[model samples]
Target: MAGALLSTPNRVSLERLVQVAKERGYTAQGEMFSVADMAKLAQETLGCQAELLCGGLGGPNRDGVLQHLITGHPLLIPYDEDFNHEPCQKKGHKAHWAVSAGVLIGVQNVPSPGYIEDSELPGLFHPVPGAPHQPPSFPEESSPGAIFLLSKQGKSWHYQLWDYSQVRDSNLQLTDFSPARAADGRVYVVPAGGVKAGLCGQALLLSPQEGSHQLGLGHLPQLNPAH
Candidate 1:
């Protein structure tokens, strides 16, 4: 699905992609798809270059994601499924992949103080009768912001709005899949138990073979941050 979204002017079928991956030996246990596998698929099927942006301590951080998005490159983010739902009867961690659509940064309104007297000129300013002397100020810190994710549920794909913290935690908590490249130069999946390490802020950025096609800020819709 993500490949299809990124491969504009060219259409790619999921069945063909699976067939190609199987032929290239990119799948795990001949069925599962890993981040590396997907990267290889994107490279071969879409004629795009793949770059893995991984953090030192965790899966890709918020800054890395935002930077890739700013460059108009959509990301393939794999994370722990527990981040989205409460643990049920499942035993081990389950990992899921999603495509980043965009981010949502809320617009903060700053109230006016109405009027104030000038310190230098005594009669230069006048205060409104009902206006407060000073209006409340917002904090200097930047908002963490939320993200738009294109994810699959059951057999259908949906767009979800998730808090950036959830995405960050999920990516860091992944413990079911690890990236690995086989001897044949195929990116194969390594069992998390064998590796004994999580993805640690890993994400894949897909760029066209020609060059990056940047998305203007005007193309994104204005939305409030998710609570």
Candidate 2:
């Protein structure tokens, strides 16, 4: 009943998800809810495409705030840590995500946080060769928000961060959950089962100051139970 009430036809709207994200302090954002190649593959292999939402989140302390929304998936946020003892001065890093054997790994793209545009990440990560793996100083200064990662695995989900040297574990219990108020005095909800979005799916960038890029829903033929 909780999931049913939260999702219509078993799907959550991107608009609703954005509303919740804004309440949590992430204002500038982007989403990748579907991919042309992935949709094609799903149609050819299973006759039904996978419908999910993935994207980026940028704001003050957005890196830490994003951890609350990550569950068994990945989100791209501005890399907020010092690299090998140097403080990053811009949005030059990204947190990439993938799941192997049910473990969600958030790979930190060091040296240079990747760029964020109207679409998804470039999908090509070239970390510095022989990058040093040293302890990152916590409570680092805030950087402009970047991207986010989301995914699903069987019945269980998780949101964990991993780099070449360490993995930081995090989780959000969103099932049958009630609305929660963040520091902004706004109440928001994380849908039951975490919104049925995907890690590497279709996405749009969210900017509190600008409009989003849109594709006619008519063109998205693979949207099952689309919102």
Candidate 3:
């Protein structure tokens, strides 16, 4: 006789499938299908209790809504493939804060007309939001955490960002002046985590010292554990 269950999956059966996945790993490609399928897969595979998988490829195209990945457990899903806020020039329907944050950091060194930049950054970083006229020029970032503030770029939120490592030394306390660094350079500080779906865990950032612009958790193995 076959070992696997043969009957249709009930709520209990389905949850068990998900639980087994959690103990082993959470990178299953899901039931292998469409948006609804992806959503269901997120719910089961990522253990999101109730998955959304919103925005971009597997989500709705609505503005001002929080495009979450799942509802229960956390999963940091990247809404955009390129992760460009505003998508393209003359086409940004609304501001995507995640993109905007990276844009600010990316264009930190561009020579453009705008608010005066801090002497330390010269023209690298800014505090205000950009308009269609003064669109941001995001060259790149080597990590994803720098854009955490803007991750909630949708109307659902407006998160305050911090570079705690920029402010504190190894002690994790505010110092008069501390410039200690992490391997990834700057890490965005939040109210102790749990920002939103697709951005709950720390979204790693680019290293100020390194000349890289890669972010997003590197691809997880596709069931092939022996990498």
**For candidate 3, lDDT tens digit of each residue in 35-102?**
23333443443332222323221112111111111000122222221233312211111111231232
Candidate 1: RMSD over Cα atoms?
Answer: 13.5
Candidate 1, overall lDDT? Answer: 0.50
Off-target runs (Cα >4 Å) in candidate 3 are 1-53, 56-103, 108-111, 119-123, 127-133, 140-227
TM-score of 1: 0.59
Expressed as tens digits, the lDDT of each residue in 75-139 for candidate 2 is 22212133332112222122222222112223354323322222455543332223432322222
- In candidate 1, clashing pairs total 7
* Model 1: per-residue Cα lDDT over 101-165, one tens digit each: 55443324433465455689653333344454442232222345423333332233456666566
For TM-score, candidate 1 versus 3, the one ahead is 1
Score candidate 2 by TM-score against the native. 0.18
Q: Give Cα distance to truth, residue 174, candidate 1, Å.
A: 1.3
* Winner on TM-score (2 vs 3): 3
Show where candidate 1 strays beyond 4 Å. Answer: 28-33, 56-61, 82-92, 107-156, 177-200, 211-227
Question: For candidate 3, what is the lDDT?
Answer: 0.26
TM-score of candidate 3 on Cα atoms, chains taken together:
0.20
